[model samples]
Target: MCGIVGYVGKRDALPIVVEALRRMEYRGYDSAGVAIVDDSGHLMVDKRAGRLENLDAALAAHPAGSFAGTTGMGHTRWATHGRPTDRNAHPHVSADGKAAVVHNGIIENFAPLRAEVEAAGIEFSSDTDTETAVHLLALEYDGGEHAGDFIGSAYAVLRRLEGAFTLVFTHADHPGTIVAARRSTPLVVGVGDGEMFVGSDVAAFIEHTRDAVELGQDQVVVITADDYTITDFDGVSQQGKPFHIDWDLAAAEKGGHDFFMLKEIAEQPQALADTLLGHFENGRVVLDEQRLSDGDLREIDKVFVVACGTAYHAGMLAKYAIEHWTRVPVEVELASEFRYRDPVLDRSTLVVAISQSGETADTLEAVRHAKEQKALVLAICNTNGAQIPREADAVLYTHAGPEIGVASTKCFLAQIAATYLVGLALAQARGTKYPDEVAREYADLERMPDAVAEVLKTGPAVRDLAQSLADVNTVLFVGRHVGYPVALEGALKLKELAYIHAEGFAAGELKHGPIALLEDDLTVIVIMPSPSGRAVLHSKMVSNIREIQARGARTIVIAESGDDAVRPLADHLIEIPQCSTLLQPLVSTVPLQIFAAALAQSRGYDVDKPRNLAKSVTVE
Candidate 1:
């Protein structure tokens, strides 16, 4: 999956598409290009092998955006089936230059399709599966069977593709419209006054209008300046679900922060508050979009939380709370590996799927697999009307609007807050907790936004510590209980942003193996338990810190305020407000994010768009 932009309107397509592609550069940064249809019926595609700026330079010498038409498509490819070279950059053009295509998602059967097309005397120019689709569309448009019907030709081309893809194309013969199709990856239509837009996400078009229609699976859309028509691959008409984006264009901007990461970090408190808003009714936790009834929740005996990457860490944190509150056996599984394991499932099983972009390929496939076995699927997502939420039995949306940073900041905390809501709702349904107890926990959760805000205020110290450790070759994170997942997430952020070798270990498992790597010059971050309560855990963690410090590892402790035991052993001590055992993750995780971002910046890396990573993993 990558960035996709298509516009058919009265505005100049070049400047509009270039600006939109810049907005979506976080989606893919390997290469950027655009294909525009000029007034003289020329299909012009100018792309380069570097960042969007490279394409900007390429367009400078030969401006395709200055063409005399307002219909075009742009793409920023994150190399899937080819290398990041000039030849492999999109928009992949047909040999005749009659058609061009920009694509997201993997075309799994492109090899066989390439073979078929080659046998028919169609030569390929680029080493991309995207090229094969463009050639196939040209053939369909020029063939004896479906000649001269761009929309029908697009429908035919889509029916032959084997894997998930969102395709938007331009035809020189039909400069007034663009044909787009989707199978699994994201594609949405932006409806405006006298024009329409298509994008991989709503952010691409939010600046123009908030009126968006989310395209469903296996649907094709034909759009012009005035109107759009949605149809199935088989030519059956369908209507897409329309929704308004709650956030304005400013949410996707950096807002004068040094980086989008920093801005998103500062937005976490408000994000947490929004996620927990209006989730209570009549002293019991309420869910607005629940299709699974209280009777269904009461009958659930097992829960499986499935996700990938940072979301997988959120799922790990959710497992602890779900099992503790509902007394149901909970299992955390990597979404990419969940379906392959042949796990048993039944009506009594509840699968909780977490994804910041609900379009994550592995998690979406996992949800489908679970539903096939008669399991109830619940989605915790940020994007409204995303496929995972629309397909699941129920959904709880984390209203963290438009996290543009490649590394998750606000969404991670919001997800944790949502998980807390999920646990409370389950407990209320199962009679696992008294109503007063549930109310108290709910109130505590509501107040966590302030605690998170307090932690955000303490970010400068972590940034300072990170600047000191910029030259450190390796780092390690250790924790107990909920902090364990927080450690893993912290380590992951370090590796993703700082490009360092980092690992997270359970603090109690030190002697087994992780401690052997504790030598001089290596930094270890220990997330300590709250000392006010859980005294036993606090004592054990303090012992773990001392052991690591004794081993010559410089230890950084994330401890609670007024906790004095860790002060003597810690090389750097960061304090957070004391909260309940499970909720410590909300505050304890903040500094790690700040530190990772600062360290990456000190190393001269782009914290907003890390190398070789996309904002959304839309391909499996």
Candidate 2:
């Protein structure tokens, strides 16, 4: 995963590109660099192997007049090919120093390309798959059928490259132009009067223009100061899909919160509302892109939910809801392991792929695998114009805007809402739920925003609880049904943000192994089922809490406001508004998010950018 920004505008490119990199730094923070064609028409690159601030300090140490250009590109790298060092930073230059390139994904054929270029007496200065691209471009431009053509040489090199990647190239001689292309990885163009922009995503140029063009797979783009052109690798012209970004720059900002994670956690109510809006129309549940007919959905005999990390936890909930509502056999698999298992799939199988950023490598591959087996794929994503949605037979957008925090918050809730919508849609299509019943379920879902908002009121109490357990070396979470996934997600958040050992178990499995970890003062977080809706689960959870408490463990139970049995059992009771069993995670998850962020703050850890993690996983 990496962030890339390329601009050819009338204004100074340095500040614009640098600010864009700052906004996209959530994508990657291993290293930072910028390539600008100075006023003298010479390529100038400055990079450092650390955070963007390290590159900022390097730039500040130099005189302001040292670098100036109207055409430039910038990169913030999450190193994959080599170690995070200066030599492995992006904006890698050619041996001839005429071409500079910055790239986002892995190059599957870089080894052979590197060997071929080396045989031609080109010694690489850095150990990066991206370095081979610049060398190949220089070689192609210096002498070939397309000699003296910048775009032609760039396309020639791109045609030979392999794997998922977004690449931007600049030549010192062509200061007014930049060449960019993408295959599998994301790339977009920003339209502005008297200017043009290209980047890995809209956030790179959102400050200047919301009119964005999303490039399709294997497409190349050439951006000049005043216009842009899109084409295939063979030089055939193509049109990009244009769309407007609804939210402004303020949405991406912290909004006075100490960290983006805290602000995102607080935005869950609105995010859930936005995701559920317009999904229920004409007394029917609708998806955003429904290329498949209702007949196709009704014919589906098996369902698979594939995802990774937080999205995978959301998939676990999807499996529970889909099977319960539609009576279809549903299986949830880790995307990385889905294809390898040779899962039995066919035209009757429905593969639901969930990803916040549609470009997640493993999920994308899983989608491809399912498609290869003739399974219809539906993507539930937060991002528009991303690869997974583009490739899916249908899509249900989460509408979570942008999640800048490396550890997801609002997006996870939005995804859960999307999954429920999918379940309802399938149930309706299969005639499992009556039309009036579907409408009633949707009306209940529409009430969840208020429930989530009510849950936010418990933040101060959750913060206090988190502080009390901040010094504890271990924390365990337990729940049944949908609450079990919330427990897993809560444990994941603590482990991600607090850097401590945590685990989540099904309430019934505590005695199997996890109960052995309990000791005096050990903290165990419990997600209580709504007693009115699932009295059996609620009673079982109470018994589980009592058992943990008897073993000298301190319990923090998230339960409904009127659940008196669990209220007395919990050492610290975090009450949430009562909701249906299927929708409880929307509220139960909020406190755990607050707890994790607050706990990490108490431990003096960065709550937004967890170490060794990127916002999007573009590399497998």
Worst 10 residues of 1 by lDDT: 61-70
lDDT (tens digit, per residue) of candidate 2 on 376-468: 999999999899999999999998888999999999999999999999999999999999989988999999999999999999988998897
Model 1 per-residue lDDT tens digits across residues 365-403: 999999999999999999888889988999999998888
Candidate 1, residue 201: how far the Cα is off, in Å: 0.9
Pull out the clashing pairs in model 2. Answer: none
Best by lDDT: 2
Off by over 4 Å in 1: 63-66
> How much is the lDDT of residue 209 in candidate 1?
92
The lDDT for every candidate, in the order shown, is: 0.90, 0.92
lDDT of 2: 0.92
RMSD (CA, Å), candidate 2 to true, equals 1.1
Q: CA shift at 337, candidate 2, in angstroms?
A: 0.6
